[model samples]
Target: MRRHELPRTHAAGRTYLVTGSTSGIGYFIAEQLARTGAHVILTARTAGKAELAQRAIRHSWPQAQLSTLSLDLADLSSVRAAAGHLATFADRLDGVVLNAGVLAQQTRRETVDGHELVYGTNHLGHFAFAAQIYPLLQNTLDSRIVTMSSYAARWATLDLTDLESSRAPYRGFATYKRSKLAQTIFAFELDRRLRRGQSSVSSLLAHPGGALDALSPKRPPMPVATTAQVLRARPLSLIAQGKDKAAWSAVRAVLDPQAHGGQLWGPRFLRSKGEPRQERPTAAMTDRVVAEQLWQLSEDATGVKWPSLSQPRRL
Candidate 1:
């Protein structure tokens, strides 16, 4: 687990898609998979960003097989277009790391479809994208989707009536936590449906404790850092680790063949930093009633359905 050493997955035909791969934990997830000789598709809001990420990965491992797609989750049209484009090339998807999303923003925002920006991008946008790509996953046995959630979600209070934060007061951090909770609920619900349908596809969740860029190793594709800046963040290293270490759970969720659906994997200690391990999900994430409510809300918002589910009405 050193910076220079790469884990050997020995995956050649395995195809994965990592959203928000331009930087942070997502970038490292793509990098990890690429190093193992896996085929990866790095997604970004624009074709240029995606291309740059592809080049960045290849620059390190010349044998890396990578592709790029332009996907703007804030725009429903863009999600549809990206899914369509992906279907043309990716006949099957072994796994997907749902990592693209905005963190806490200073002010409330809205997506192109008029939904609250944070919930729209982090939850609903991924909801649609996951639904659209469900067919590809179905085509591949044992395919899975790994959702990236946050420890902060433990602080959220779900008010389904004001799910969009339109009527409720919006504290940036609190609202962001709520969005993570929604997605976590969505992941569990998808796992339940996958089970009911008896499909081999799985849905799992993974989260980082607290990721610090300064503690992360510097690479040419990412932003440059000053020595002073690295030292300034050293005190925080006591609790948090770099995005490289934070990405371990996600990579395990993606590559572990023995992994089952409905399992939560995360950093080993205090939900912060260590090896990836199976962990219990918070009660809110596993509640069936709340998950069903969010699932309905997602379907209504996204106009996408899981083709595998024959009874999408009740489940």
Candidate 2:
């Protein structure tokens, strides 16, 4: 299928939570779900953005079932508060799109939690949110948690000793790559744990090929003309697709009935943009040792324990 012709999956009556849904790919994901008659819980960093998103969706689908939550993935407290608010909702979540993230910051910074801003917001924040709201996911049958990764993950070299980038010199791109790698690792590890516990909730990973925009304020500015020219000369630029096309991998990962735990989905033509399809993750992303270590580190860093699945709950 062409990029604009991506197929839709059945989602009527199901409730989905999509972080950073006020604009860009996350907005489209929420809109698509709402279009299919699903009740969409849209999250934003502020109430204003959330209101705009809701208005946009309502403009397109007057009767769309929608609710908004204020969440800042950079703030662990915000994530926890959002989870607490989410628990008050009347319906069980059918899925969650862990799509909030930062591309890269111009300078090294720290979150309020005192970790590298990029790593903390892109990976750790989502880690805590997913873990906290996991029981709600578990309560739903065949529910999914889709963690958004990036093409940069393959270039990352994770050092277990310095997951927070404390010991190493900070390079913006390197830090961002490691964060994406962490996301993929967490997704796969969560899948493994869920399987071990005999739970039905699936954990999936996806990357937007070259999609440029997301709702988060932390997104880096577009490259300058000279930089764009240099990038266009590189082979990777050939696969650079629009944001809408880039979101397909994530949309498919969430709604495709055939999609399963531990699968990595992205554009069909490797890094180049095309129809979404199952793709192999990097060796680092699939390494059991790396995944386990990252999981432990996430639990330690976030102070959120993974829920026990000894007794799987049916929706």
Candidate 3:
């Protein structure tokens, strides 16, 4: 479906924060929210990129309620500072899309904080940000936190003993898959905690299955089995959907009235390309023990702990 043909739920007066909104799927997600009358807080690593995103959104919808904030997900200090700035915005936030992430590189690297780059940016940064700004979401009525994962998560084998890949040999694709798995686990664990605490806030996960977009610079070679799976997929990766369609899973998780916490959404076909829908995730992706372990590791790594709530708050 075209961007215009996707569901555009009314979001007038609601405020949403989208990380990595300067380009690609993040940009499209922000644009869709802004077009529906939501006040979109678009984040970029630099002032120039943020300005460009704002201009693009305004050009498309002159009346768009938009703002910009600087965020570098690879840097913990920057993530904290950005969260602090966002906390000052108002009493509450209607939604937050944790969409910023780094693609797999040819070699392993570490973030400024000394963790693996992909793990730090894709999972830990968002983890810290979410913990800090969770109060805002809790106060907001029926608020949602939509985290972006990836199909690469299916290939992940998270080693609790070597969460940072320091003790094991590092492969770029494996590291990237680990980061996505961390995100998936985080989302599910968060939802479980929220429900256990009886909080109104919801946590949802979404993935842009095989969309050809800016963040994905090129396709990496797959194993024989994975390659066959892709080949059998409808439409194949040769003609995969664009970022806008890939972003719909996230948009739906964010705005669809039927969407609920703890659900994972992705494309409707072959886990590659199609419209957004609820999809079954791998068993490892939904493993509660793994999720709890990851939650603890995230807290330790980021030094940010989620606030404990005794009961659900009225919206």
Candidate 4:
């Protein structure tokens, strides 16, 4: 189908909360959604970025319904506060794009919540946020939860026994891969739970293949000074694709009628720069038993539980 032939989202009165909307692919997706008339809540760690992004969006779509919210996914308290704030502002949420995340940091650090920086920010935080906001989604007509994963997740091993990586030394890129794998596993697990309970909310996952966008702009610690050395070693612009393609994949997942629950979408070509295709999560990431275990672990770690579960375990 042609570019214009694809279904454009019509979200006149709907409300959407897109995490990490201040930059990169998240910003693109949130902007597109706001342009379509959705009351979009763009989240950032600081008020300045959020306000800056909101203003940029308004500059383009003058009448756009855009707002900003402070959310630090690495901190569970912040996640809870954001969820509560969203609940207070809107009775229901039509869609949520879990696009905010960090990349391979050179050093080993922990969030205020004490989770390994990569796994904490990439997976656990989002897990808590999603679980806390489960009710808001449940109240919507056809709510959707969209998570951003990565191709590196395929290389990961789900080491649930030591989820915090305290048992092993910090290996930057590998840890990132593990967290992404957790995301895929989390999405599958969430879908299974939703299916078992027959809930209307659906979970979907997507990946933005090697993009040149500054995915990790912050500096790494001295030990891992060459943290993003790989990017510098190669011509990133040549090897990496554009952010627009990733936005298309997200838009389709959020708006396409044919998009089914639990589906994973990515670029259609070898370089991840063409049309989007429906891809299944890797076997390691889709194991139902592992997913359930991860879900239980996440609940224990975050202290948030979905009420729709048949057995609501105390966190």
Candidate 5:
């Protein structure tokens, strides 16, 4: 079953929020969701980009129910404010996608909150933002939360002693990989928490392989600038799977009722080309005990308590 080829069902009254929707894989996801008649909130750091994306969608689907929301994932305060504002406009949220992330950057940098740029935007900011929208997701029927992880995550490992990577030597690619691994692990942890609380929402994890698109503004700088420029100039869309194909992995995990929770999906070809396939997390991701500890550590680092999961569910 292909993602775009999946059954076309109307999501008339349903609402979805897609971060980093202004460009790349996230943009395509938002466009497809809008086509299905979802009240889609397309988010980006700048209002200009957000509006441009909204307009682009409307141009294609005049009746597309899309709105722009500004959110800077690199900054925790910005994330909190954006999530807060979203709550006021929507009564319930059916889908939430953490699609924004930094790619390969050459330099080591920190966000406004003094956290590493890659980890801050890709993990901490999203981790906290999702927690803030706890209530809205709870109110929906069979809600879904999708977080994007990359195949590069295979190389990522958790450094308990240096979770922030401040103590250890920093390599650009290594940092990105580590953050992606955290994203997958965090998804599993979120699912566990939701189930424990008896919440209907299912937390899902996915990734777009070497798809041709940017993620978020806070994306890591390209480690190999020359190679990137060469590839771009050559218009190498032929070399990798299109962004649309890559995004299917996410669409399947989010919409397919039969799909399992806490699984990763990627393309079959090298770097995820062709149709998406099921991918298991590394042994590190399956370690429930470690996942729990990591979840706690993330909360502590971000200073965001998951209010929705604070109390046990009363049957």
Candidate 6:
């Protein structure tokens, strides 16, 4: 059945969980989903941010079904707790947007789990959370896990020996890019596993092309770039887009019927910023060897794995 198109039944609406919805592209993803009358769950590092995001969504989409959960992806305990709370909070889950992530830190940082902050929060944390909630997602009739990735993934190269970049020189931007690449690899690997298991759950990826805060719309409660900044960004609009518009790709992956597992959704213009459409990922993005390796490393690092998916087969 098409849950997205289904009438708002008395039982409840299609439930979608969007992480890091307190601001940036994550907020927009949650907001857009709420606008469709879906019961959107917003997650932030703290209860305050979550509440803020929920309020902002409610203010604009008053009728929009909304809830909030505190999730600190930098901490595995928090991810587990949030997933536990999430499983109990909702009876059904239609989709999950893994949109929460730290980007472009000026200095290299480590997560509470002792891994690189960028990789830990963006990839490993989500991986563990997804595993924690795998059963809930499986119970849902048809569910999808849409990963919010980046164009930086294409430029990334993984050093499995030093996934944390401790041994290697670490540029904050380079670490961030590698983290996105790791997560992107995980997304494809997950889809393959789901397909192999014949599960109803699907995994997909979306990248918001060159999203800039300066180009985004002012949503009131949330902060926005200054008028001067916006004006200065006008010339760059040819290639970049506002964060609000950038969110459409992830939103489409979460709810669009045509969005299938393993497919990438991105911008139409310059493949970065425009209407959401099917995007062609580069060869590196779909490399199964690296994906398989990353999956093993992720399972080992997170100490979480899907029990039913232990066939020991590679595609």
Predictions in order: lDDT? 0.85, 0.82, 0.83, 0.78, 0.78, 0.83
Model 4: which ten-residue window has the lowest total lDDT? Answer: 216-225
Residues 102-212 of candidate 3 have per-residue lDDT tens digits of 988777799999988988999999999888888888888889999999988988988898877775567888888999998998898888888888888999999988775
- Best-fitting candidate, scored by TM-score: 1
Any residue pairs clashing in model 1, and if so which?
none
- In order of appearance, the predictions have TM-scores of 0.94, 0.89, 0.89, 0.88, 0.88, 0.92
Off by over 4 Å in 6: 1-12, 309-315
Q: List the residue pairs that clash in candidate 5.
A: 102-219, 102-220, 103-220, 104-221, 104-222, 105-220, 105-221, 105-222
lDDT value, candidate 3, whole model: 0.83
Candidate 5 lDDT score relative to the true structure: 0.78
lDDT of 6 by residue, 178-197 (tens): 88988888898899988898
The candidate with the higher lDDT, 1 or 2, is: 1
* Predicted candidate 2 versus true structure: per-residue lDDT over 150-268, tens digit per residue: 88898898888887777546678888999998988888888888899989899998888775432112221221235554455455446566565777888888888888999998888
Q: After superposition, how far is residue 128 of candidate 4 from its true place, in Å?
A: 0.7
Stretches of candidate 1 exceeding 4 Å from the true structure: 1-7, 310-315
Off by over 4 Å in 3: 1-4, 214-239, 312-315
Residue pairs whose backbone atoms clash in candidate 6: none
lDDT of 6 at 156: 91
| lDDT, residue 7, candidate 6 | 20
TM-score of model number 2: 0.89
Between candidates 4 and 5, the one scoring higher on TM-score is 4
User: What lDDT tens digits, residue by residue, belong to model 5 across residues 192-279?
Assistant: 8777877778888888887754212212221123555545635555546656667777776766667765667777666556666778
